[model samples]
Target chain A: MSSSTTPALPMHEVRAEATWLQRNKMIVTPLLFLLPGMLFFAVYVIFPIFQSFGISLYRWDGLGEATYIGLANYEELLTDRNFEISLVNNLKWLVLYLLAIPLGLFIALFLNQTVMGIRLYKSLFFFPFVLSQVVVGLVFSWFYLPREGLLNTIITGLGFDSLNILGDPTLATYGIIAAGLWPQTAYCMILYLTGLNAVDPEQVEAGRLDGAKGWKMLWYVILPQLKPATFIAFVVTIIGALRSFDLISVMTNGGPFGSTRVLSFYMFERALSEFGFRMGYGSAIAVVLFLIMLVFIGYFLWQMWRDEREARRG
Target chain B: MFPTPIEKRSRAAQITYQSLLPLALILWLLPLIAVMVFSIRPFSDFTQGNYWGVPSSFELFTNYGMVFFESDMPRYLLNSVFITVPTVIGAVALSCMTGFALGIYRFRGNLLIFFMFIAGNFVPFQILMVPVRDLTVDMGLYDTKLGLILFHVAFQTGFCTLFMRNFIRALPYELIEAARVEGVAEWRIFWFVVLPLMRPAIAALSVLIFTFIWNDYFWAIVLTQGPDAQPVTAGITSFNSQFVAQYHLMSAGSIVAAIPPVAIFFLMQRHFIAGLTLGAVK
Candidate 1:
């Protein structure tokens, strides 16, 4: 109002001179800004989800006439041995992958000191998380190679039998999960390291004065401060566990009797691999994964919403 | 501080802690160290069954040279650059607008839209795979780098928006309000006032998104094929098949494939960690 040139102009003329867009710039501007992003997101991310649900109801190859299957793909999943293995493997991934959080907290506690060269050590220990999962998988596969591998060399040197980890069905999933855990532990470590940086000195001093130390101090004082980090670590770890396709694709290719196949890898195989493009079946598998993810997604969103509310109230 | 600083400990304990740091680091990075050692060794050592021994010959240059000069590794790397750069720019650009709108405004459905981006980001990629592939093919974009970039930009927008909006929100709102009171256009405020302050966030998101798009393997395979358009992550598979059982060359190829993002992380460590640990503390 102060910037208006004709401060003495009639109020009716001033109001008439303002265009609709000018009058509603607050609403118009945000809507205009949101347009392109919303369009792309809806087209590529949001709509695809509902489309997958719809696609799961019909049998359609990539280049063929569609046949409405109406949950038949899901019916097959009920009896499909591969699907069973994939689901169970997914569960194993969810459970085992979570070990990264506590393990990460441990490493963070160890590295939280103010030693010289600690920065380099911290980055080096966090190195694995920066490398691509594909590279990690390749490195581990070579490490686990049967005859000339380093792992076997060490085992034999220690007078223990050399084990072909990826070649055995029972061990393959665990082997791949171990590989997955390397980067994941590094990721969680970084989160906790950041969390530990912000821990209040006064609280630590108080805890010390109260005779808290080691595990007791950590459980009572440090862990509470690390809750935000733990929450994020949990979210990322669970998502990483479900999104276990790249490592499996690179290392095992769902091999060793398909024991390492998770829902993600199985969905890809069903949808596009040479085994036959069963798009509907793949869609069905994807829907199941999405539903599982939705549970966690809902929880994360609810937490964020609660935080947002608290921020508003405070 | 929680672990008790080494300075406060006894001298022997201090020495032990310092010595144990390196030992623990070596153990933590053993697998990667093994690969680095593998990459530098000559093929003669592998043939002589001298694996894990001191390299009979250091062939670092020779092996990486073959990857660059004699294979499709160069093409794949270039493709990776093309794919990653555009996706980073596109996602960051779009999210900046979305984040600005969501951050600055008090419009209806703002939180709803914000939650949508968050939820979409957390959905498994497989749920979006088939339809996105179909949509790409429908637009005659499959088997093209553009197809991959378009989809990556869209999907990553979810996460980017989440990061960006939160970053924008943390900025002082008074600047925007002051700009508005001064009769500055909304778009001008976004461009001048908000965007200037968003440099650190932009830098962080760019580095984070660069690593993500560069390391993307599943989409590379799903969207493109062969050396023509496939990024290094997908092309590494073929690179491996071409040099099967040639451990030295394969290791070199893998190292080459992994270098760019690792390099970026080291170069921009501050921003990278800031982007990653955005909400971990606060």
Candidate 2:
């Protein structure tokens, strides 16, 4: 009987061998699937960062021959008034942009109820975030457009003089920041809404039973649970503040004596725009921005690492 | 759940709250509403201080026509679509593979690579500006949609990869083990077994990317200059310059430029929120 089944045994062995190959195929297959993506990412994203760092060390117009400038651009940046102004404005933005978090929390708390047509109201509130910043800038510019603008029309209706929010050097930056806050606050509201959804109802009930009410309930029980949402809102708001170029460009073009020139927009004006294409100096400004962001990036990465490790351990 | 519900309050409080709701919303949206109203108002309304009043005449069509015919609005729209669509497709497709590899495979540098992506996603765009622009010019892709698309796809990969990897990681590991025991190839396991389950993630990512790339003004301005490659955001800047003081036309153009992403948000509001708040809840 064993000899009669020998041919069938060979066929069976061949099928088993094929099965073994298939089972172990992943050992070699993922590389094939990952190559194209990795290549594109390396070329377009990863490599360019290093390339930019290299370019920062040299002086070159985009078209002409390149010349190495070493720390000369950095030396100039140390004494550059415009760079200082831009840096100061960025600090202001960082400080003021944080207002979005509290404002967003207020709005989120206001709209958290299960009222009739609440969904439509929520969406309507979120409309600003959906639109482009350019549109937001335009809308705000019109609103801030002297006496005939919406803001002034309302101010005058109350018998106050029309305020030129964008024209005044002192107020221009704040005006632009206010426009930025509109969408950013909406963004934060959405995050808080999500966070509110996951709040421990039992904790809330217990707090209420303990005679906690109003601000006490919020301060003692609710706000602590919304830490994750607050953290993200703070992070994105800071980044948004630092990267605030569009509103500056659209609203006032960093006008009224360049009072609103954040580092990001200042870098763009120096490097690319018609501001003499000072590539090396522009790179220097970028390096400063990069250094500022590096601090936060490191913190965020550390936090994320800790979270992941804790998740895995649990 | 955090605050006392409006209904549980006294009658006067509820009435006051309801009244304040619309008022707060109106104040919050005053700028946007002003633009919407101005888009339809005649030029005289702006000139004659009738901004907040009813439009003197319905000039919506005429103003919208001016944006397209009098300016390079059509070209700008095309440029935006060209750059955004390709970037979304390329970034999503690449991340799907990268995500699968990093999520499932136990590798030495997996965490390191994932962290690289997360860090890269947060870095300031200005830091990458000089070298990226130079590279684009070197490759003769500057002032072209291709240049913009390549950069966007690359930059967006950091984000897309982070999202995709986290999404893929949350799936049950046993599915892959079972597929392996059944003698399925790894690539086949990814394509036939895991890929189908990524539909919700893909949908979420696609809409998010579409809105992000479509509304990107920074790269649009940095990479391209002329109408030939200028996206709507940058194009509007130029139009603002050309049509300075023509508030009616500018408002119309703003509305036109805003339509696409707003439409996307309404269509995929759930996915958009989910994608945005991926890490917020937990």
Candidate 3:
């Protein structure tokens, strides 16, 4: 019972031991664990942002010396017609891509029940999102092919003239957007399905007891709980819309008179592709795209921060 | 459950709903179904204008082999695996540490760093494209699989860190505190205690990152040019161009390019969906 009193160690020895532990563990341990990750992240991700910003003010073809030219590229962007087209197309993408959220919610609702062979149904529906965008683009391109394509065949079978979707500038952007929606809707559906799983059954039953059903029940009860899912859906859809390069690249190569060009594809064309290595102009385009994204980024961070604060409080 | 179940509906309504499901699915997936059919059909079917009929002959194996023998499809597949695997392991390993640091620790710049990751994760690839490419070239990694892996690992770390941090933060802090009070070293606590709990997160991220990197066409085109480093997504582009009129071969190649990720998804559908919808629901 009195073991503490039996052995009295020197206070200096105890202090020395505690200090050594602190030095070796608290300070050194975290450093060892953190250094490798932070270093690479800083070098490749964090450093590149500032470096790109710096290069945006210079005229350089990736290899040669970067000549200083402050704001000239940005100034040129103001009058560039293609930049204008890309910007407009980006706006169109942002608007049209939001459709996926509702479409996905509908699909999720349709498949939410426990039915026979439902697992197979869900997987089949989820199949599109699993495939690569390259495949999606190729498939859609074939679908939109002029004569023998699925779309034209369907149209011609109905005694209508074959509609040239990818060939027509006005319809080409919409055509690509539709193809993009195929997977995006699937992604949204998965999110909504997960959301639906966690929804309180009691609330639905209570709403039913109160004679609230269908859209009324959804708006009044279900949607409130689905806020988190909807917020994520919105954020991802927005990001997907802005970062739509692969589909545009594969399906049209920003072709049919550059009408379908978004900023990402346009930037790629300017900087990397065989079109021309106007690195400065490309960076300028990148800067604009970055600025556009910054708005949403700020909003997303604020929302996340607020949510974390609420989570902490709870 | 919010909407009325189809079973409870009138018989007419039930029949309409049940009958419409397959039709809707078919219409929704018409493009994909068309490609699937075309991938199996003989080349003569296209030339003969027998687009809607049964395939003249099933040529799936022949077409698939043609993609590999006639083109750089094998190299592309190898490049994809090379880039994707390393990037997944590297990003996940790094993020586990960073996430532990940010999530478990209460430091001055913790929130700042977390928000930085969140913001950085959302930035367009274009913003980083020029300098990233230049940096890769300067480091002598341009047009190499290593260059693609490096960028992907770095880029994906932003997202992975966010996910891992939130996941770790949700773990009971008392366990770490209890270990520390027992005089356990911080690194040991992380390795023995925290790392084990991260298996689910790691699995989810592995599948998700595998898909993202495998399907990445942009970086493949940007960082790597030739067959030596190009992944299947970009390689399929070249295949498409070479087989301009050969729809059967192109379709076959597209199917081949899609198989890996599709297999991963089907094998791990639950984890894949869970990973995708991680932040979507509370």
- Top candidate when judged by lDDT against the true structure: 1
Q: How well is each residue in B1-282 modelled by candidate 1, as lDDT tens digits?
A: 688988999999999999999999988888778888988999999899989888998899999999999999999999999999999999999999999989888777889999999999988999989999999899999999999999999999999999999999999988876776677777999998999999999999999999999999999999998788999999999999999999999999999999999999999999999999999998
Q: Indicate the docking level reached by candidate 1.
A: medium
Model 2 regions more than 4 Å off = A1-31
lDDT of each: 0.92, 0.85, 0.87
Model 1: fnat (fraction of native contacts): 0.82
Candidate 2 structure lDDT? 0.85
Q: In candidate 2, which residue pairs get closer than 3 Å at backbone N, Cα or C atoms, i.e. clash?
A: none
RMSD of each: 3.0, 5.0, 4.1
Per residue, candidate 3 scores C-alpha lDDT tens digits across B109-193 of 6788888877888999998888888889999999999999999998888899898999999899889877766767677898999
Give one digit per residue, the lDDT tens place, for model 2 in B118-203: 88888888888887887888899989999999998888888898999999989998898777666675778889988999998998
Specify the highest-DockQ model's number.
1
What is residue B282's positional error in candidate 2, in angstroms? 1.6
Model 1: per-residue Cα lDDT over A1-314, one tens digit each:
22322222223444557866666677788899999999999999988999999999998997888899798999999999999999999999999999999999999999999988899999998989989999999999999998877888889999999899999999999999999999999999999999999999999999999999998999999999999999999999999999899999999999988888999999999999987999999999999999999999999999999999999889
Identify the runs in model 3 with alpha carbons over 4 angstroms from their true place.
A1-17, A20-31
User: In model 1, what are the clashing residue pairs, if there are any?
Assistant: none
Give me the candidate number with maximum TM-score.
Answer: 1
DockQ scores of all models, one per candidate: 0.64, 0.52, 0.56
